[model samples]
Target: MNEAIKGNILTPSGWLNGTISFGERIEDVAGSSSDPMLNSDDYILPGFIDLHVHGGAGKDVMEGGDAVHAIAAIHARHGTTSMLATTMTAPPEDIDVALAAIGKAVRQRGKGEARVLGAHLEGPYINSGKLGAQPNFARAATIEEVHRLEKLAPMRVITVAPEISGHLELVSDLAKHGVRVQIGHTLGSYEEGVAALDHGATGFTHLFNAMSGLHHREPGMVGAALAHAEFAELIPDLLHVHPGAIKGALRAIPRLYCVTDSTAATGMPDGEYMLGRHVVHKCMGGVRLPDGTLAGSTLTLDQALRNLVGLGLDLADASKRVSTHAADYLGLQDRGRLARGAYADLVVMDRDLKLKAVYIEGERCDLNDA
Candidate 1:
């Protein structure tokens, strides 16, 4: 499986105008001027790692079967090398079915698909008042229930409303078990958000959406995260959060990463699609519910990078927001960087940032079928 490619390779130290050699893992990254293969005008950067992905390509993860594989393959075409199969809030039996399907996808990653790292349980333990696009199945979480679900699949990330009954303690317990807890879909106050962080919740889910607002007097959950959080996820589709607010978050949170938060409408034409238990319509380049509330997005990571760059972020910094910081969030050291001894997961793009090629564990993807 040994292979090599030459371009302006991005590494931890900086960009190197040279060649990178690898098998399943990178073996070497060296700068050279004389190699004929280095003549291509391309940029080599780390592949994207999306932490919040529900579904895509007209298939919903909640469908629970080979649909996860279809979603993974569609995202892989868009340069996502690894992702979490994010689950929406559903009834217990439905959630179990979805988790079991994701567990299988994690165990056996299909060819030409993004690596399904694990599940991101984003619901069922959130506030009923702020159930943005989520069904009305919100309830308090129990440690026993979480433990049983984890047995079906690794819960890499879980979103909880700390203001819910006993959820602060649950956050601490889940953190102790090495799960990355996030605060979202809540009506909690600023003090409650801070308390969740003190209890070991490390990140905020989709900052500025479905959470409390940031007023000068109130300083709600958004304010707490803006003031104190080191890491948070923001959907960069330009529709979810305004570019101005995104800039504010960028100035505030040091490691503000991007997530697709994409639904089954992604990679498909404008039409009706399923997002969990609700049926959403896609039109005017956005997906929405019957009441015109934005459900999920059709954003892909490649477009997310372009959107960030369009917002005046430099390419390198934007790449880190889309790739490096997310890998850092999940403590995955091997997947997000292009360096020796790292996984050979990378994306090749032209000067315009359009995807040229993608590699996952040294296997080149056929973008024609993407």
Candidate 2:
């Protein structure tokens, strides 16, 4: 695999006109090249890192196995070179099994994204009050539960309601193990939000969705997430969040990371879908429940990239959000950059922000390419 993969490289630092070489192993990358490259007018950026993604291309992480491979390959086509296979709230035992199975799949990586960094368990211990669309059976995580699950995966992240019982202690415990605790789907008050943040809770899950609403005087969860600018995840599919709110939140949380909380229905046909035990309908270009509760998004990373730029986000910032910002969330130093030594995962997109090609460790991928 000694090939120079060249493109209009866009790093968090800025864009560069050079070639990046890939070696056989994960750490190998060529630093310099003298060959003249072709003009693409394309945005060649680091391959996207989606920290929170359930399943796509008709597979769910909970159904772990070849489905993991199938869905990941599908998403890589959309430019996600790396991701944390997110699982929905489910029975504790089921969660453990799913985690273990995914751990194996990732260790023996075949197809799909170049790398499966780890697993993101959305919850088993979450506040039932603001569960939003998360399955009801998998309740919030307790301190005892965290101790068990953290040992099951390489990387771990969870979305919790800070107001739930054992929430603070759980955050502290998880943090001690290097597991990132995200605040979301919560009904916590503004003060509670801050309190949770104090416990080394690095970021928010999906801001302004399942959590408490905003009140000028009270300043609920949204207020807390916005007021704390260091970190928060935004599902900028325009459907999950309003365009204006997306722009405003990005402004408020200067270090906002964009994600697609997309489900198995993402690349599938518009029809019936299942999110945990709930039967969801993928219609009108978005997934929804019987009462029209927005289930998941149809927006791809490219769409969100365009959305961010449309909302006045500069290339560098948007590039960071889609790349290194996510890596930062997981504390991964190797990815999210186009430097000489970073993993050679890359994405090439047109000016209109359409994904044309994706490379994982210098291997060209994009299911449609075949």
Candidate 3:
């Protein structure tokens, strides 16, 4: 059955007061801001795509099984239509188990859940010294091990510290195989970061958090990311980075985007939670380790959109930060915009950005979907 939803729809070109008709795919966007078809106190926008989400609803992606569905359902409630199941630094055996489980989820994901596009391996190949909230599982990347992981599941993105031994070559190899390479948890200098970009690293992970900061003289990994990388992900929950720094990054790199970098603490009341192997405390400020290291966040994409708007960005620009840029970074052509012939993945929210409903392939999804 074809369905039409009317409201203030954000199409790729601009806003239109119209009705969007869809089945499995977007059939068309009709009507106009002046002569609208259906009227409501809702705003329609493309569903968000998160490239760096750990978990939510008290479930970690590493837990696998129905955990994937639970997390997806939780985020979908907050406007995420799809996300990459991100993994943390862990022992080789642990990593293998998580990878195999993620692979299984990807293959057998249900229609009611957010699409698990693939895996974003954020660990094991990073620099130990800059491990931030990651445990002491950092190491150099090897082609043999990476190839094995890829066989188990599609590795969409991988974070590596370029200064690690044999890592630049690994970056080149992974990039050649079509996996997005990101620089993070690194102690590399600006020069090394530029070299990584030259070799195929296209982005920075959770910019300005785990990577070195920019310096006027030395210009570290943060500087290289601002000065070079085609795209970068920022945790803009107002806790991971200051609003001023987020504004600066927005002005500097047009392609800079937002990621939840969320954890099991998200959507749950203040409490302690596990982010992979480590224990994190979630309280009034944010999710952090007992020692006060910022482990992750409880921020949802809907809140991310509001935070960006709170920073004075127009709604369209903020939506782009949460949706379009990430999709473009991942090379996904089908989503991230409300254009004709696009996937019917979308979110419905009030003018305040409070999520009211979610649609994945034209199917309304709720917590009950789990």
Candidate 4:
């Protein structure tokens, strides 16, 4: 079935008052701002792509069953067309169970759900001292262990502390296998950070949060990222990071993107939720531990877009941060932009930036499902 929509469409070239026609893939886009029917306040943009997602709708990804499905559905309602099922630092057995579920979801995407691209192994290979909100399962990365996990499912992204023993070699090996290695949950020095990037780590996870801070002289991991990284992820919930720091990262990293790092508490009312083995409380519009250490987040990508805009970024730049750059980081050309021959994944928003409609691979999603 062919479907067509007319509005202010964002494209690679720029915004156009256009009509986009599609089925499962975008067939055509044509329009002019001078057209008489350009009075509508709606804006059509590419569907959001989140590289980090733990869970949503009261289900934790670590729970491993129908939880990933529920998480996908809820995030899709918030205009996430695709996401990686992120896992926390846990024991091998627990990780295996979670990866099995993510693999199943990736192979079989449910209706009205965001496409589960793959797994984002966020830990079990990080610094225990910098384990912010993550459990105490930090360890070194071994190719054997990584290969074993890879067999269960494709790992599109993995966060590791570069300073861990033998991880620099591991980073090179994983990068060769096409995995997107990210630096995070570490107390690595600035020199080590640059060395990791030189070896193969291409991005920073939740920049300025768990990693080391920038110092005038010491220039820690954050300094390494600020000075050299081309890509990094930020939680745009306004709770995780200050707006000023976000602006600084914006100025530093060319492809700085936004992620939820969301837990099961997302899209749910304030309450207790599971983030792996830890019990995280969602309250006051943020998720945190009992001692008030920030856990994951309750942010959705749609809200992430709005938050970016609120931080003085124009809509086009904000859209790229929440959608395009994340896709680029994963080396996906078709999923991020709305172009001819691209997947028909996009979101329709009103003038206020609230979602009016969402399409995932040409399938319209129920906005109220979350």
Candidate 5:
């Protein structure tokens, strides 16, 4: 069935006031020629594509099976049309389970759930020194292990520490197989980060969280990312980064995007939750380890949008941060814009940036269902 919705439709050029007709893809977007400043009412925009997400709704991606469905359902309700089923630094068996399950979900995504783009193996090849909230499952990257995992399921992205032994070669190999290599959880300096990018490390995971910090003489991963990395995912829940820093990143890296490093505790009440092999306590609107290092988060993408808006970004740029940049980063040509023939994955929000409705593949979602 064809469907049409009227509102201030956000397009790549700017805001358009009219109706969008769509089915599986956008059939047409008839915008009002007389463009007035968009009001603070029902605004239609592209659905968010989260490149990094762990789990939500009390289910971890490591749980596998229906856990992907649960996580997708939960995020779909919050306006994420698609996401990577991000994994943690776990043992080989655990990683295998997560990869298999994520591949299955990608092959057979159901209705009423966000599309699982693929698996983002966060790490087994990261630096143990900078493993923020990740367990002690750190190891060096090896071609044999990478091949075995690829055989199990398609690996869309993998995070590595450039300083890790034998990882530069692994980065080149992973890139050869069309996997996006992200640098993270490392104490690597600017030189090493540049080397990784030259070897095909195209992105940085949760920038400034687990990687080395910037200094005057020896700008580390953070500096390298801000200055040279092609893409970087940021946690903009306010808890992960300061507003000033977020703005700085936005100014520095035009391709910078937002990601919810959310955990199983998301959408649930304050309580204890598992992050890989460690236990994190959730309270006071934050998740943390027993030693007080910040864990993941309980943030949803809608709230992330609100945070950007609160930080004084206009709607279009905020939408780009959550949708366009991520989609482009993953090379998803079908989404992230309200253009004709794009996937009809969109979000509806009131003036206050609150989620009013969500549509994935042109099907309306029950926001209250998850």
Candidate 6:
């Protein structure tokens, strides 16, 4: 977006009326305004970035096709500009196919939806004890499997159980391939979790939902996320993790991030939805088991933001949980901030926090279907 579009700039202090100048490409941020302009009526924070999102608008990223394209558009409408196509815990072949699909979208440059930086390979490499919705048959990746992914050369982030056999070596291999490793779906102790971090595990995937609860003596996976100063992913639908737990997780983990971890059930009516042959029934704000074991959420990041604000969190702080912090987890320096040099990929919202517009690579994306 050239032609010197100016608006209210949201700084850490507060909203300031200023002109944000840009260069030829969306990646360039140059120029300054001595005299500020525009009103401070709403926010101008960085756009939302979701590192874990399965699918929405009745489309599954695993289903391939235009799933990434469609889900991206729908999510952008709710305030996500850059995101990862979260893969479910599936068979090795299924995972490979899903990841290849994500690679296609990245190559084609998906339209109107959130820009796909890479794929978040959520499973086939996790502890079965905490596999809430994931199929138990799939477990942590072997050294050979990790090496195969490296050979594929696809942009991939992985979640694994640190305590699982071979995962420590897998973590090192993945990190070598530039794959971001996260500790999730695990029964790992705090010590093991910390070890994974030392080995290259950068964050946690949906920290409390599938992982073991924290204990006074044991200090399980959640304990590791809380004690370590690394980023912890949370589904802030307020159902996946309790409101009280959210507060505590935030206090425990210095960089707690919000992710949808949503399924195809999201943006669809309450009914049976397929999450790779597992029948996920949408109930309330999430998908769950018949026994009420909470599956993935159906909540949007926009609602997550509202939940944070209603919980008395500052808007900027809440926005960063999805945008800035998640971006940091993915190691994406060019995104997560609305500053001049960052990609113009952004979401504009109204006072009610409803999404008004999305700019992807400087073009205004039409989110009518979302």
Q: Against the true structure, whose TM-score is highest?
A: 4
Indicate the TM-score of model 4. Answer: 0.98
- Give lDDT tens digits, candidate 2, residues 37-88: 3454566788888888777777777876676777677778888888888877
**Candidate 2 local accuracy as lDDT?**
0.76
Q: Which of the two candidates, 1 or 3, achieves a greater TM-score against the reference? A: 1
Among residues 3 or more apart in sequence or in different chains, the pairs in candidate 5 whose N, CA or C atoms overlap within 3 Å are: none
Please state the error at residue 368 of candidate 1 in Å: 1.2
State residue 202's C-alpha deviation in candidate 1, in Å: 0.6
Better structure of 4 and 5 per TM-score: 4
Per-candidate TM-scores read 0.97, 0.92, 0.96, 0.98, 0.97, 0.91
- Considering only N, C-alpha and C atoms within 3 Å, which residue pairs clash in candidate 2? 124-139, 125-139, 125-140, 125-141, 126-139, 126-140
- lDDT by candidate, in order shown: 0.94, 0.76, 0.87, 0.94, 0.90, 0.75
Which portions of model 3 show Cα errors greater than 4 Å?
Answer: 33-41, 367-370
Q: How many residue pairs clash (N, CA or C atoms closer than 3 angstroms) in each of the candidate models, in the order given?
A: 0, 6, 0, 0, 0, 4
Superposed model 5: Cα runs more than 4 Å off: 33-41
- After best superposition, candidate 2 residue 107: deviation in angstroms? 1.2
Better of 2 and 4 by lDDT: 4
Question: What tens digits encode model 5's per-residue C-alpha lDDT throughout 275-336?
Answer: 87788888987999999999999988898998998999987889999999999988888898
Task: Name the candidate, 1 or 2, with the larger TM-score value.
Answer: 1
In terms of lDDT, model 3 sits at: 0.87
Pairs with steric clashes in candidate 1: none
Alpha-carbon RMSD of each model: 2.2, 3.0, 2.2, 1.5, 1.3, 2.9
Put down candidate 1 lDDT per residue, 1-370, tens digits, no spaces.
6999988888887778888999989999999444224456688999999999999999999999899999999999999999999999999999999999999999998999999999999999999999999999999999999999999999999999999989999999999999999999999999999999999999999999999999999999999999999999999999999999999999999999999999999999999999999999999879999999999899999999999999999878999999999999999899899988999999999988999999998888889965
